[model samples]
Target: MARIRIDLPEHFAFSTTITLLLSHINYGNHLDNAQLLGVVSEARLRFLKSMGYSELDVEGVGIIVADAALQYRSEAFHGETMKVEMSATEFHDFGCDLVWRMSEAGSGREVARGKTGIVFFDYRSRSKVTVPAGFRGHFA
Candidate 1:
C-alpha cells in the first residue's frame, strides 16, 4: 500500500473560512472523508469567484475536474472553523492543478491538503480547449 503526498506551495493566492456543520460529521464524530472534498469544492468556488470567474466560465471556457488527490492529516470536528487556502500550479496547455490546504482556523492544525486537476473545455463544442491566457496571467 502507498500513501498520497501533496506538496503545497509556499504562498496561497486565495483563502476562505468555512465552519463544519453536524452534517459534515460521520459516525466517527469527525469530518467525513467525502465531506472534506465538499469543503474543498466550496473553497474552489470561492477562489474562482475572487478571480471573477466560475467553473462554468473561465475566460471563454468552462473547467472540469479531471482528477483529484488528497492527504488527510487530522480529524476535524463539527463547529470547527476551517481555513482553506488555494493556489494554481502545474500548468499545462489545457489546464492546471488547483492545489489547496485545509487547517483549523485558530490552531493552524492541518486537516488535509490536495490538488484537483482541471481541464478547460468548450461545453458547446464538447471538446477540450487550451488554457486561457487571461486566466493564467493571474497566477503568473
Candidate 2:
C-alpha cells in the first residue's frame, strides 16, 4: 500500500501550544499515537474558537470529521511543550480539510503532520449540508 501524503498549506491561520502529559506517553516512552490525535483535537478546537466557531457549531452547522491522516516524524516526551499549527484547505461544496502540523516548541523539530476531512452536518436533520458561504469567506 502507498503511504499517505498530505500537502499542507503554506501558512497556518492559528497556532496553540500544548504540553505532553504523563498519560500521553506510551510504554515506548514517547507520546502515543492516539494521544497525539487527542492533542490535535484540542488544537483544532482552539483554532475554531479563534475563528468564532466550533466543531459542534460553525455558522449554524456542525462538523463531522470524515477521515484523518497523520504522519509521525519525531518522538515527543512528557512535559515538553509542543506547538500545533492549524489551517483550512481543500474546500469542497460540502466540506473541507483541516490541515495541521506539530513541532517542538523550542527547537521546532517537526513531530507530525496531519489532515482531517471535515464535513458540515445538520444533526437535527441527520444530513450532510453544504459549506456555508460565510464560513468559507471567514477562512478565505
Candidate 3:
C-alpha cells in the first residue's frame, strides 16, 4: 500500500502550543496516532476562533471535514509541548485545504504534517454551500 505524502507549505499563518498528556500516549508510551488528530483539531479550533469563527460556524456557513491526511515523522512523548502550525490552501469553489505542521515546541523538531479538506455547508438546509465571502476575504 502506498502512503499519503503531504508537503508542508513555506509559511504558516497561525500556531498554538499544546502539551501531550498521559492520555495521549499509547501502550508504546508515545503519542498515539489517533490522539494526534485530536490535538490538531484543537489547534484548528484555536485558529478558527482567532478569526472569529468556529468549526460549525464560519461566516454564517458551517464546515464539515471531507477528508484528512497525516504523515507522522517523529514520536512525541507525554509532557512534551508541541507547536502546531496551521494554514489554509488549495481553495476551490466551496471549500479549502487546511494544512498543519506539528513539532516539538522550542526545538523545532518536526513531528507530523497533515491536511484536512473542508467544505462549507448550510446546516438548516442540510446541503453543501459555497464558501462565504467574508471567510475568504479574511483568511485567503
User: Candidates' TM-scores?
Assistant: 0.98, 0.97, 0.96
Best by TM-score: 1
- Please give the lDDT score at residue 51 for candidate 3: 93
Error of 2 at 75 (Å): 0.4
lDDT of 2 by residue, 18-69 (tens): 9999999999999999999999999989988998888889989899999999
Question: lDDT for every model?
Answer: 0.96, 0.93, 0.93
**Which should have the higher TM-score, number 2 or number 3?**
2
Model 3 misses residue 71 by how many Å?
0.4
Question: Which candidate leads in lDDT?
Answer: 1
Candidate 2 least-lDDT 10 residues: 131-140
Higher-scoring candidate on lDDT, 1 or 3? 1
Better of 1 and 3 by TM-score: 1
Q: List the residue pairs that clash in candidate 2.
A: none
**Candidate 1 accuracy as lDDT:** 0.96
Error (Å) of candidate 2 at residue 85 is 0.5
Give lDDT tens digits, candidate 3, residues 1-140: 99999988889989999999999999999999999999999999999999999988997888999999999999999999999999998889999999999999978999999999999999999999998888878665
Tell me the spans in candidate 3 whose CA falls farther than 4 Å from its real position.
Answer: none
